[model samples]
Target: MRVLEMLLVTSCVLVLMVSLFRNTINRKIGTIAGIACGSLLAAQLLFEGYRWQMIPVYIVAALLVALLLFRRSKITKPLRFMILALSIVLLGVSVALSVLLPVFHLPKPSGGFSVGTETFHFIDADREETFTEQKGDKRELVVQVWYPAAASGRSGEKNTVFPKDRGLFHTYMQAYSGYLGLPAPALDYWKYSRANSSIHTDLHPAINPYPMVLLSHGMGVGRILHTSQAEHLASHGYIVFAIDHTYSTVVTAFPDKRVTGFLTEQSQDRLFEDSRAILHVWNEDITFVVDQLEKLHSGAVASKFKGMLDMDNIGMMGHSFGGAAAFEAVYSNPRIKAGVNMDGTLFITENRDAMKKPFMFMKSEEFTNINEKQAKYRKTPATDAELKELRLTREQFDNILANRELELKLMDRLSQQGQGRTIYIEGTGHYNFTDLQLYSPLIGLTGMTRSINGTRGAEIVNRYLLEFFNQHLRGTESKLLAGPTEDYPEVKYPNSVYQGE
Candidate 1:
């Protein structure tokens, strides 16, 4: 919460406590406390801004204080009880809103360079939006690029982290709510949040042809969901491009006021088939975006990236479905030097072979355990009674087993080639790999995600990502990647060739 928000809540509590004992306290003392608390809250609303969620509580408190100041002697016993009860109810509602829809702050990037960001709209003319039945339609992507900016432009400049599109946040929260079955308005507070990067500022002129990294968000998530990670890479001198895969992303707001929401009607029962279909499209999305980047570099497109993109040393990273796309891109596209899969299960069954380039598989503890358990279940098939106890349908159980087996085959191939690293964080879940952890610790608190702190998780992921990209893309040896270090004890290298070396 912001400073004034905290103060307002505290003042509400004080006012409520004073009102509870209004009959016992001296009239003058009660009046002064009521006036002080009410005045503080009024000041917060007048100057600090009003949050609609808490307005009802604020009004109730203000009204109670006003009554206590003006009609202290006229207050009957039953009326005093009603006031106390109402205050308690209002306080509870206020606190609940504050906790659930918190104004979360992203952790500052711990790097040398300040970050600047810009968004570009690209139309993949050759491809059609297969997710929809629209004929002759080109697949569109909104790519947000974050890069190191010149520090000299910082004076008196407000660092606006979020894009100018107001509808984007509403769309994101609405899609997220639909996916999770939560109230859409519960996440509306995110509309006010901002990122750490500045708006389309001049690129840091000292570095030419900056190493580039492409970021892909998980399914039903927008590219901005990984803003913290993107900013971190930008702060450390890597130009990062986070792509919003049109219909696949939670929301994609185009320049022409067109908003594309996630394709939720796709096949959920046929998970693998749906995933594969989506993964294929996303892989094309990545390659197409890279082609656009080439155009930007060649001055074919009006972009600041002209002559600034180091296409030779490009890397790809993604979360969940995006991660699968990253792996597929690395396997199929020669332009991509390396890749990182942040807990994304490989959906492209054909590309199970060892990736020729360096790749890292960062897994969440829950996913790692689930995969291992599923693999074991495949070997030792559970009896009918055991299966019933597990509450998994025969098809569901078989799918889990198959997915586990596929993951093993893929990881085994990568491990054998000596270019892959498989590591999992001790206290993390699939969502920890993305910026959702940073968005709300409530996710972890409510058992919606793992217990790992979002900032710490991002820091760990960023450290490994930086090291991996630096080593492969920049030819800089990262001791952190050579072997497990004591620096991040929570990271475990399971079946990793780099382990024990």
Candidate 2:
């Protein structure tokens, strides 16, 4: 909570306690406490801004202060107790909301430049919507682009970091909570969250043609889920484009006021089959975005990107299912010079050996030796019924095993061809690869994800990510990639071709 918000909650409690003993103590003391709490409430509103969730608390505090100040009316004993009980309930609800929907702070970018962001919508006319068969409808996508911006010391500029659409954010949060079986109210605070990038700002002139990096989020995750990584790369002079894969993402809001939610299946076999099909769609989306970039460079699309994009130099990265898509994208499109998969299981089975460009696989501890029996046996702590509800069937496990074997085989093949590197963090989980780690410490406490410090994990991921892209895409020498330094001790290189600290 912000400072004033904390003070507001504290002062409310203090005023309530003092009101309970109005007759036992001097009436003057209760009056002064109420005045102080009222002052704090005003300060909170002035500083922290007003939220609907705190309206009840505000009303209770105001009534408490008004009643204390105007003590001419002789209050009965039962009335005093009733007022106290009501205040207590209001305060309890306010506290619960504050805890569950914390205003989380994202880690600052370590790079030298400031970041600028913009959003774009594109329709791919060549491809029809396979998920829905509405005749004559084409596939559409919403993308957020973050780029290195001209450095300015002034930080007073109004910026919309996350999606500014309240309805869209609320729908996204509702879908997320529903997917996790959490109460919708548990994520209600997300509407207030913001990002660090300034919107539609001027691009940095230091580098005319910035090397572009494409980012893809995990399945059922929003594009902004990787904002931390995107901002980091942008500050370091890379134009990052993150896509919200329509129908596969948690929620996508288009320009025409239409909102689409993710498509889910209960059958494990159908889920796997659908994943492979969706992987192809995502890969096509990447290629289509790349095509749009080419158009932007050729003055086909009127915008600041004209002649500012180095289409020949590009890299791609994704977390979870998006990671698998990145790998497939590198194989499918020669335009993608390099790719990184952050703890994603490969779903595509055919043409896995075609990848010849630079590639990196950053695995979580749970997935490091996934083909091993012990690794496969280490099931999540959820109950059997819960697992069933989550769709973790035996066939799903078999698919995971098969994907791991294929991943290992591809890594080995790429290494032999001098094009692959694999590394794993010792105490990390699948979600650790994205910005979700920075949102809440309770994520680790839930035993669903491994307990790794969020800031430190981001630093480690950012360091390697920048190094890998720098070495492959920008032709910069990276000592971190050649051989790990003592800087990040948690990263382990399991393959003989790759080195660790």
**Which pairs clash in the backbone of model 1?**
none
Give the number of colliding residue pairs in candidate 1. Answer: 0
Q: Model 1, 262-315: lDDT tens per residue?
A: 774445368788777777888898989899999999999887778999999999
RMSD of 2: 4.8
Per-residue CA lDDT of candidate 2, range 16-56, in tens? 77766565546788688778878988888877778766777
CA displacement after TM-score superposition, residue 132 of candidate 1 (Å): 1.9
The count of residue-pair clashes in candidate 2 stands at 0
Q: What is the C-alpha RMSD of each candidate to the true structure, in Å?
A: 3.7, 4.8
For model 2, the superposed segments whose C-alpha errors exceed 4 Å read 10-32, 50-101, 152-162, 264-267, 270-273, 349-351, 374-400, 445-448, 496-501
Query: Which portions of model 1 show Cα errors greater than 4 Å?
Result: 13-36, 46-48, 52-60, 72-93, 154-168, 264-270, 349-352, 383-400, 445-447, 496-501
